[model samples]
Target: MRGLFIIGRTTAQSIPTMLGIIVISFILLHLMPGDAVDAIVGMSGSASKETVAQLRETYGLDQSLPMQFWNYLSGVFQLNLGTSISYSAPVLDVILERLPATLTLMLCAFVLALAGGIVIGWAMAVFAGRWPDRLLTAGSLLLYSAPNFWVGLMIIVLFSAKLQWFPSSGDESIGAGLTGWAWFLDRAHHLVLPSCALAAFFVAIYARLTRAAMLEVLRQDYIRTARAKGLHPMLIQFRHGLRNALIPVTTVAGLHLGNLLGGAVVVETVFNWPGLGRLTMNALAARDTQVLLGILLLSSVAVILTNLLIDWLVTWLDPRIRS
Candidate 1:
């Protein structure tokens, strides 16, 4: 019952938050300088006023702001994100087509970061005040602060250009179809560079957070009592301290998951990957309002859902949170 109540409250809060985001996004998009029609038509000097007006009418851009908002809201409820001005396909269709590639890349990167982070963090905690901990801490800080684009460029220079170990761009081989182990292996090979680029920042963050949390837990009365009872160091750390440290890591990881979905824009663009981030970038350049709005809505929903899942997990992991 307590858990259900927390969920209910969270849902209620999220409703207003999503609505606020929509309103702010719409206004900010509209307030940006330059005419959307002019952008679509290439130039005002070449296009006549009549042609521009027609384009505006075609996209319902001439409608009152309130009416436009109402229409968009209604379409969202009906799962009709409308047709993209640039692509001529439904916005949802465009999003669905590009989503899988992004998800696959993100999932692989997330798994790598999560596993690597926990192990490194655990080692640091166990070897606290030792050279290993100091080395990892220093290395993580350097990687965390380095620009992602620069790291990507270095990876390409070494692996793709210098060694010729991996392809420099695109998600898959030209001849590899979207099936079979051969195709899968090719895709995974391409994934290596981009995933590593994405995981570097996450690795630093998770290691730091986990180390801090574990250090705190290790000083707790229970940990001290366990050590006093002559429990093995590995057992005491793994069986007791690790679970408590996970609570903070869980929160950070959950928030970063949502951020990764949207924040992959730079990484995706750098790699020339044809994911939603790239698609959205193209749509923005073309002033394709439908596609832009569709991507924004999808990202917003993903963030909300990820956070909600984390909330539920917190309740499950620590019953006190339900209270």
Candidate 2:
């Protein structure tokens, strides 16, 4: 019941948050210095003034700002995201088409970061203040502060150019005759460089956060009692300390979910991946308002939904928070 209440409350809050996002996006895009109509007309190779006026009318650009926003909000409620001016396709369709690739890359990177971070963090906590911890702390700091794009380029140079291991850019290799598992393997091969580059900074951050969390949990009375009870060190660490430490880490991960999505835009551009991030980049370059707005709205919604899921998981992990 408490969990349901939390969810209900979050859902209610999200409604206003979403509205704000829509209004802000609409106003900013519409109020921007550059004219979307001009952008469209310019792209069409010197369109006549009549054609320009007709295009503006077709896009409802001739409407008053208040009226246009009202129509947009109404369409939003009806699942109408408008049409992409550049692609000549539905904005929602363009985003949906590219979503899977983004999800795949993000998920793969997330899993890698999570696993690597936890393992390294656990090891550091186990050997706190020792040479291993010191060495790893320095390394993590370096990685966490490095530019993701620069890291990606280095990865490509080493793996793609020097050793000739993975594909430099793309989610999958083109023109391959492989199928089934083989095709999947090729895709995974291509995914290696980008995923590693994207995951590196996150791994560094999670590692540090997990290490701090574990240290704090280890100092608790329960952990001391577990140690005094002659429990195996591994058991006490894994079953007791790490489990409790993960609570805060989950919150941190949820907080960073939006950042990860935003980072995907740059990462996807660097890798030339055909995901929503890359699509967003192209849309921005072309000043395609429909596609850009659609991508931003959907991305924001995804982040909200993910945070809600994290809240549920956190509640499940620590029922005391439900109070």
Candidate 3:
């Protein structure tokens, strides 16, 4: 009951937050120099001034900014996200088509980051103040500092270009018509590189965070008590130390979900993955306001919901918070 109340309250709070995101995104996207008509004209090679004027009027781009926003807000209330000038479809439909791909990529990267970070961080913590810890710390710093795009390109160059290990650019093999495990495996194969690229910095961050958190937890009196109880060192570290240390990591992960989506824009572009991130690039290129706004709104919702979940998880993990 308390959890439900917390969820309800958090969700109620998020309504205004979402509204602000929608307003800000709409305003900022509109303020950009080009509009759907300009992008259409460019795509079509040329258009008469009269044709251009008609295009703007057709898309209601000729309306005043305030009027446009009002109309958009009205449609939003009705669950109509407007139409994508580039796709000639409802913005929601266009986004839905690409949503699964992005979700898959994100899930893969997220899991990889969390699992790998925990393991690596555990090792680092166990080897604290030793050469192993020092080595992992330096490596984490390198990964954290490297640009996602640069790391993506390097992975493509080495794994794709030289070693022929994995396909560098795509979510799946086109026209393979594979079924079941074949299709799943093929998709996973393609996902490996992009997921790694997307997860590199996050892995570094979580690893470092976990290491610090574990170190702190290890210093607590409870950890010393566990040691004095004659518990196995590994069991004490895993069952007691790491479990208590995960609260901060979980919170940070929830907050970083937005940044993960932002990074996906570059990763998808680099990998040519058919996800919202790639779609976002295409929308920006074409000045597709409807699509851009839809993506932004949906992303905000995802982040809000994720944070809500994180709150619940943190509460469950640490009873102190409930008090």
Best candidate (score: lDDT): 3
The collision pairs in model 3 are none
Off by over 4 Å in 3: none
- Kindly report which residue pairs in candidate 1 clash with one another: none
Ranked candidates, highest lDDT first: 3, 2, 1
Instruction: Look at candidate 2 and tell me the lDDT of residue 289.
Output: 79
C-alpha-based local distance difference test score of model 2: 0.86
Q: Point out the higher-scoring one by lDDT: 2 or 3.
A: 3
User: Would you list the C-alpha lDDT of every candidate in the order shown?
Assistant: 0.84, 0.86, 0.93
> Which stretches in model 2 have alpha-carbon errors above 4 Å?
none
Output the number of the TM-score-best candidate.
Answer: 3
lDDT of 2 by residue, 1-323 (tens): 76687889999999999999988998888766666678776677798889888988988878898998888788788999988877888888988999999999999998898889888998899899999999999989988999888888898899899999888888776787789999999889888888898889999988998999999999999999999999999999999999888888787788777777788888898889899888977887677777878887897898899899988878777857866
Give one digit per residue, the lDDT tens place, for model 1 in 1-323: 76687779988988888888777777777776654676877844577789989999988989998898889889988989888877778889989999998998788888888888888898888888999999999988987998777878899999999999999889998875668888888888899998888788898889888899999999999999999999998899988888889898988898897668665677799899889879978887877776777788888888888888988877677767755
Residue 124, model 3: lDDT of: 91
